[model samples]
Target: GLLGRYTPLDNGTDTVDEVALLELMKKTGYSMMQENGQRKYGPPPGWDGPPPPRGSEVFVGKIPRDMYEDELVPVFEKAGYIYTFRLMMEFSGENRGYAFVMYTKREMAQKAIHMLDNYEIRPGKYIGVCVSLDNCRLFVGSLPKDKNKEEIMEEMKKVTEGVVDVIVYPSATDKNRNRGFAFVEYESHKAAAMARRKLIPGNTLLWGLNIQVDWAEPEKDVDEETMQRVRVLYVRNLMLSTSEETLQEAFSCVRPGSVERVKKLTDYAFVHYRSRQDALDALRLMNGTLIDGALVTVSLAKPAAGRDGGGATWRHGGGGGGDGLFLFQRENGGVEGRRCTTPGPPGLLPAYGAQRVFPLPPGTPLSPSSLQALKPYQMSSYVSLLEHFCYQHSWSPPDYYLFSTPGPKILLIFKVVLVSTQNSYLPDKLCALVEDARELAAQHALWSLGTHTHTHTLGPRYAHTPTLTLWGQGTHTPAPTLELKFVQELSIILFD
Candidate 1:
């Protein structure tokens, strides 16, 4: 009877009648609280009930702005018991066109979604209903570099409600500055959602800069099952000059053969150990330790879900970058105590055996019978020649790109480009079943360089070439056109 007197306008922009709204709230036994631009109604002042269960909340959107709870509640309650109703409002008293309704039981929320989704509330207005994910974190971007945690929290509280905590990542280059963005955690999902709406582009400015806002990507939790298989550690904040050999030597001190492999990226590296215990020991000793005059942070590397079982890419935190470690294990689905011998160059010496195997894509069909490994003589003749030339010329390392073509028979394409000179070369001979793509590609590169009868002077230094590709070859696979360029300047001679 009381709700009948407070009918909303069709245009939905009418100023709210606070006195009538208060009377309706009291009559309906609903408590009310108002914040910056939202009104929450639930848990009546003198009443008590159990809190809404998890998964019992439904998000209601596309509401008619003029509509109020008195008109909206009856329709929502038709499916279940109401625990709380939060209507996003504006200073002008019109509704913000959306609301969240939590039911006492999860089944009621599900039923509400099934029954009222896309239900028409008026002649031309249909409201959308769905499960609320209940995320309580927000990603705040474009923050002033100089702002600290304390300064940011104070500023956020002035414009929004339910300010709880701000999480800022320190810049790798400058400890005093943040990484230009921070994560803000709210006490509840409702508060975070309200802050997101208020902080959206063009709505507000923080520290004289227009900042960006969105829900923070939740970090995946690592479980005991994952920890059981972890033999890798993600190491970050490394110096760009750090080499794989340097890191391998540093990590090997835990025990003989403790460090299986080390992959050094731009400013970080991944260390694979022979056992999980070895990984644990390395992490404890290496984390927060100084290497090459830089403090590195080490953490357990968790395998990303849904990646290939052969090689699962792992990440440290939810975000990518130095924290992410890409690991490729053997196709046999084993990461411990397995070793394969890789022969050196052909024609130069005897085949070397009993050496450790490098990582490869899983289920790859590169068996011993299918392909012959490279010989020692051939490996040294070509690779050593180029290495000597590079050393003599004071040239940077050559860039290589490796990728596989899609098919029943995968084609490995290896492309190498020397940064200094512009000359391109293709391999005259093809080899198959090599364990390391990089080594095989280097042989092909040297063969292509040797076939050239004429010598050209090295040129000026240029920008780094695009990534080069190296592919594994089959016995019957035809050789693709390959280009090798040396762009740097030096006096060079070629002999047939």
Candidate 2:
């Protein structure tokens, strides 16, 4: 419902509750999962070789909020030529204050840590250098509020001794409080598992409230085996502009319902399928495909260690980070291997909350990554999109105004007072204006930005028709305008 409010507020223009939405999911006999950690999933039995050598992947934290891959490369290039580096992204496609850089050599990574550690990348934002670990931390949910880190640490002492520290993310809404969850770090991945393992026997309480705990690494990706207890295809190198809905639509074309869910991150995402065969099919078809002109690398994801549900330790996107629901197929009144019912609608990810939408059937869980094709339009993303279009086309600010009509779905309306100006509306010029406007709109996600709705939906390849005829018909009649579609996190919509 807050998708409307999430609309961006421009110099003129247009962005939902996360808490209220989470409560709704909880009422549905389920809770959202945790952040999906990053990984290069290997084969079914898993990669036989040792993980990347330490210092091969350097963890750089506390990065400047606006720093992107281009800017990040030079900082680490001081160490050596980098193979690639991925900034930990928020669901909104913004940087999440950290990054992982893969160097051509491990020693170069160590050199980066030494040269950049504690270096102030931005005022108040310094580079926190470390090696990417296996995320030896647990996200404790349904936690009681008002307790400081010390008290939370005290609670962890009861569960295990290998405790390192407890960190509760400050509330996005309130500064004086936390968001009711905390990360319990351990000395080792084994100790972290020991603590989370105890919680699996049943629910555990941190402060009189039943709290669910899972591996709480927000900046990493979990293997596919960690996913459905199943098979999946991992997609990476996505343009920050790509929307989850568009990703789903592209993969769904691989085969109907062949793609189940997408776990979208800052720059990459995961596509889960129903079966191993389906996963392989998706990988084979979509490993290197173009979506909105961006090339994405899709490949079979590796499976995680553990049984499904109670024994499964790995998870990704929704409910919370790094956690997904347990799937069990009952075979002749007895449960067999990990399997969920055919997916219903897409569901929302608890971690990302309102930024990305995932609609699903009753009692089913959802996560980010892909949007269901053809998402409804809102004033939020359009606010920025509209501004961008106006800026690009040089629309007369006073003569052109954009607003939204609110109903079951938000209807975005763009109105321009088109006077008979042959100077601005020459044959070739008008064609360019219309084409450029359409191109801007086309850049929108099929899930976010919409296709033509008034006429027969005009896709990119559709033949040209008069997009604006009001000026030719009569200048005094209703102004001629067009509607564009876009799906993106509201944060990206903000003009301020």
Candidate 3:
């Protein structure tokens, strides 16, 4: 059998102490027998070596969570002459309770094992050792809430073989809930190798949960600024033949300049631009555009920084403040201009009787029934109803209304009428209208149900009213109220 030996100090004193060495061998699990004139001892034929180097390579059994290098080093040194020792610490300065110890000499290491193996450093705790390699495994985290053990196992199965075991950590307080982490073990090294090859970070599911894999070591907390500068772009729907160069060519036309580098990933390509602005421009212009007959989507190149200040500001449609205005000649022979503004009436309206009259229609006119119904309300009620109606439809009322008030009291009377009609039928009519609109939206799979209130009012009075009283007559029912609330709640479930 080959003797597994390690040299501690190259120039250290070497003298034979056969008797003590032989005795140590037997205690440490090595076999020994006297032959002719010399005594020879070797590891048992089937012994792998020190039961696989416990704390050094594989950490098993409970150890103090607060164990540290300074504390652990002395204990291991006393057990065996330590050559190298390290206790892994997290970036936040927390001890990982793991330490690696190397004996000054393999013989000394073996000697220490005889004296210390199965001997508790602390009561009831024994240490083990094994040969360690540099390769380390990491656990991926932040899985979706709805993801199950079976689904995760299926994903891992694609990369490895020999299903050994997979343990999903659950919330300590909630057994049925995941703590967003899991560990997988394989029967063979090859299986672990396969898993490492297949499971990568940023693998997304329909619910927007990302799958991440890492070595089973504590990670350094990255600086916020450092994270901001890095960006990841996940391009999808890419042409199969598209290479890094092809993607570079497609994004090369971005106005703010081209990508700094492009790389082809598993099924897509990652593009890094000189600046975030360049990346944003590329996303806006290149996304959904045909690239070799395939529609490619462009997104941020890396995980976005959690801090609000770092991301690139994306401007689309046009450049500069005045770019969006459209200038056209109107039928009245005057030049007219239009631009997107707050949903209300146009801010810079032409005079009521100007030559152009702006040509743009005023915000939707109140129906005759709506005006008549509001006849009994006070001016405050009218204002409240108008505000509610505007908000419910996501509309903004005109800045100025062309009202012909006969007197202050008459004006008040007219305002009251407007409020009554609006309050009575507006919510029911709006709900019906929204339902119709929602139906249309559903046809294209574009609608997500949302809710306002039964009567779209700003103050507390509106909140406490019977659902029926707000909508008036046939429209009054608890169904729409419950339906709206349910829709709001269901939206969370649907998206999640």
Candidate 4:
């Protein structure tokens, strides 16, 4: 499968299973293949007969990454006819970074290695080739207690190339079963080194254990308490298309032989390095490299919880008020997380009677002859000044709307809407604002006595202003209950 169930076919479906003969021609520089009657079906002159058997297989590294097997075949076919091709893949269907190519003859296999080895398939990227090693050695640990030498060697061989011998260390209590570790010998040093780098980190689970690997012939066996753990890198948001091989290659390019172990999970992975410095080197090169079409992020992992005071997480507060309203959040001396709310414009205030309105006198209607005696006030001018005052306290600008005063001496009733952008208001602070507004009105020589039966229509949207007459009967005595009520309504809307 080429990363997905379907192979990209030349037929134009971009499908799977069908090989990309054209891509092969372009990369390998040849197209002819002898078919049924000794006739070449392709355009160029090429090799004779079908591909060879499985025994003549060779491993190729650093494939022009993200290429499907069908396309990769041509890159190597330049050396010989492909018998069988296997690009090892991760469980998620991503290439493992290396592939095995079987050819028609031993000579052809050798030819491929020489011609394709270190070939720059793409800019700054080259292919590496290796013949299967016949004798090599490796260390394996975390084996099940019942595992035997033969079983361990067989298992390792299934994943690695060339294996001839194995040694198991048994527990003191029994010779029949091992103490969870063993040594494996391959056909050559090359094979041993390959296994050491690829398998030693032991993120791959085997026989139910995430087995560990190192040289059984160790440089030293220090006490467990004195051993320092390997530095690990945390990689996240891996695309399902990313292969273990691609990731490993990216990290290895940073520092050769630094990546010791890799364990991949649903959308993340962990890469262990031999040393912290080497891990940092790997991070520098691979922190944002794209693999399988997705950019991956890499960082050093923090120690697990309980290691260094259990890792505290802090979040920054949003500050003051936000969104459609503001909340005046504060922590009282003893009580915590208390908040206040600000009121909206008069007509916009909640169903409660926090808003007041007054109507113009019926006999004193608007006329050009009478206009000279009345003073005009800009809506925004006063509002801007009021906003400047409240903002210092972290509140939003108030909305002051003026409708004609009805049946009265020419007085404009401006509804002072001290809207809290943070959706909160302190009672003390709100009253202070009302007092300031009254003073400002008086200073402008447009002051009107506070009273009931006031009616006002600030704009065209409101056909008529609601009458407020309760204050005359002493039913609403609280100073600026309108402001407090507005704040209460805003708070309800905010918290709800």
Candidate 5:
């Protein structure tokens, strides 16, 4: 009577009788209604073969409500031999608008996704298709808090196949008890799927309680490409007053000089390392660790913007001088400036030198207006201002000036030794700024700026003294004007 009342092709007009439905399923090769109310048709009416291998299943969604297996199975058959077709159904005898189709081969399932995804099942009605994830873990909730891992594993083995391990978390409130849920890892997706089918609501109970069972969600937030074997760590959430030297000392605990450089920002920093393993170890050990009473987060540094191949090009807007901005290309450890329309101070011209240059740190503000704020005729005031600017930005004062050939246009060469409080390296930002201007000079034959390690027996010398030398061409204006232009160019390099 149920077979007569409800047929496989029947479209949701009548409810099928359970007795006749079972007889109909027997004849049509469909399994009995599952605990979740889904009807599974494996080896669909033809061959008695084992289930398809993994990776052969595709999740199909967006089925019309009235659609049934008679309509869905044929469309999927166009892909390949059907190994299993599971259509989830409601109690009202309607399909649940989504299904899983397993092909005899993985290639066929992939083909089904390409050909039938968005395939029209009805007018203006299409289905979405994709490969189903083969999850090997099942989440079992509402477990007895008294049950330990070993006891749960023992009980689970009595009801399911392939029970590899049971992971239970301890309760935060009470350490003596579990959190009432545990993840059961299975040997394969098939084992977990079968276990889930058996453990659905009203089918089986654990410890006389109906527990929730579902596939454990897989992790998707690992940024593999950006973090692949990176040696630089980007750290954030630092204390505002944290210094680069402090960061270097903290990060170099792995080994002496393990940390190559530490670029400290307001409340963040980038730590560079020579070895990838050292960076990984540091990230694992130092992330969320307290520094200056604040916990810092450390992760692999992503490649910054404007990086092309192995070089970087930084373009800035017109600086405070109203002079057009300069373009600096960083390649081969030198920053070469180009298209700088800012002319040298009045009566100063180009006498190029082919030397490499470096840029100052990003976001370092070197004010051109500071030099302009002073009167060129006031030598004492201008020199004091220069020393003050360097001191304010934690730089050593400019003390060494090598004057060459007294004339109306004197070649004034001055060197400022970059003072490192504790280490042999110069600040990378300063290196970039000086090198950029040096290369710009080389391009136009205007002036020269270069870095060198030198010792002065007559004065205090650093262990590794890297000096910024500006070789000025003959300028009619007082040397202060030329000095102002040098500072302005450096400002442009460090401004943006």
Candidate 6:
């Protein structure tokens, strides 16, 4: 006995045991072979043909006003078989007077030249057929202002009846408007050739204007390694007095191999590096540092390349200043240039001792003779009293006022002397005084509580200092740790 294997055919409406039927046919003396003794092999089970290659070139042409694919494809197919046929349609679904015919064979495409070249498809109007390569060379002009990459693809689909890859140049400031042109790529050279033949310049009208087409310039090819190595760093909030030399000197500490170039951009600078790692390292070390009392920031820079081409051009009117772009100038003798006559806080009174003295308050006045009588207390207490007076009045007393006032000023100076006589041995006495003054101001709503420092000490000596503490109304105390403990405390307070 012989074994026969069965196979089933699923034909949508029904399933049939194809192998069993074949076996029965074989048993009935039917031969499973072709007439020439050659075995015929159909397509493999469930195997569809290969996908159309992407990025193939195609040709497009403007058709005669009355001619269409029905009349067009046969003309080409009669000369040579066609791969696909299409007629471009407008948004209104009317013919746009253009069509594409893709040939199955390149030689058949060549044959179309002899048969259809200048051949009349209608009265007094000769049809045009071009090798797909010619079509690819024609540039598309007058692209719809509102069309994007997707919309371009949809419009081109009607011309080629094949996959299209379109790249559009959009305006830098307005994305919805075209930058006047676009580049379209086809999946087949035949399709590109057809496009060129049909889309004749000066002969086709799109949006009521005669459109032009030409090969777009190829994009500049930059090596991946070179691109990866090039980095842009943005440096912002620079001091107005900061010069290019100062910026360079600040970044000079970075590893020699890291930075490639540095250019100032208005209030900020662009720092480039050989690699992202170098840029990142520079950012970590340079951000938040004081440069002329202003904090500097650093980050990765953007490349100056365009979407259509890899070359970068200035987006603004003026080219960046030759290496040292000064976005602003420092005035020398104008109003802004005048020296600040404003005074420092009164707690720093000794710095202003030469200034005229002011009378104390009427409730507790001070005089030269009484100043000696109250000098026994520690210096810290005197500083604290003056700080309290300045905080209460929202004034810088020692530097701004003198013996002109006979009441509040005299009383404040007397209180300062009396407080000095009452305390001694406060280690950070001046800082404590300032802290107490700030707290009193917070309590009275003279100043917001948000200005309070966490550990009330002289601020960092650096030009740029980050927030040192959360603002609050409280007695001053030293923090044992340098970490941001107040931030955590504030978060808990907020949640509660």
Winning model by TM-score: 1
- Alpha-carbon RMSD, each predicted model: 19.1, 28.9, 28.9, 32.4, 26.5, 32.4
lDDT of 6 by residue, 23-90 (tens): 53444332322212111112223434552232221233445543433345446557754444444443
TM-score of each: 0.39, 0.24, 0.22, 0.23, 0.32, 0.24
lDDT of 5 by residue, 64-128 (tens): 87776666777898999888787766766776667778888877887897799778889999787
Quote the positional error of residue 313 for candidate 2 in Å. Answer: 31
Which runs of model 5 end up more than 4 angstroms from their true locations? 1-36, 45-48, 139-162, 165-183, 187-215, 219-496
Task: Give the Cα error of residue 140 in candidate 4, in Å.
Answer: 7.3
lDDT of 1 by residue, 380-424 (tens): 333444555555567644444333322224333233445344342
Question: In model 1, which runs have C-alpha deviations exceeding 4 angstroms?
Answer: 1-132, 148-165, 170-177, 221-224, 249-256, 306-311, 316-496
Which window of ten consecutive residues has the lowest lDDT sum in model 5? Answer: 422-431
Error of 6 at 278 (Å): 6.4
As for TM-score, the candidate ahead, 1 or 5, is: 1
TM-score of model 1 relative to the true fold? 0.39
Clashes of each: 31, 43, 29, 37, 19, 51
Worst ten in a row by lDDT for model 3: 408-417
> What stretches of model 6 exceed 4 Å from their correct place?
1-138, 161-163, 220-271, 276-496
Best by lDDT: 1
Candidate 2 structure quality by residue, lDDT tens digits, 223-326: 33344445666676566677889888887765688766665654456666666677766777777777666656776554333454222222222223211222
Candidate 3 TM-score to native = 0.22
Compared with the true structure, all predictions reach lDDT values of 0.60, 0.46, 0.39, 0.46, 0.55, 0.40
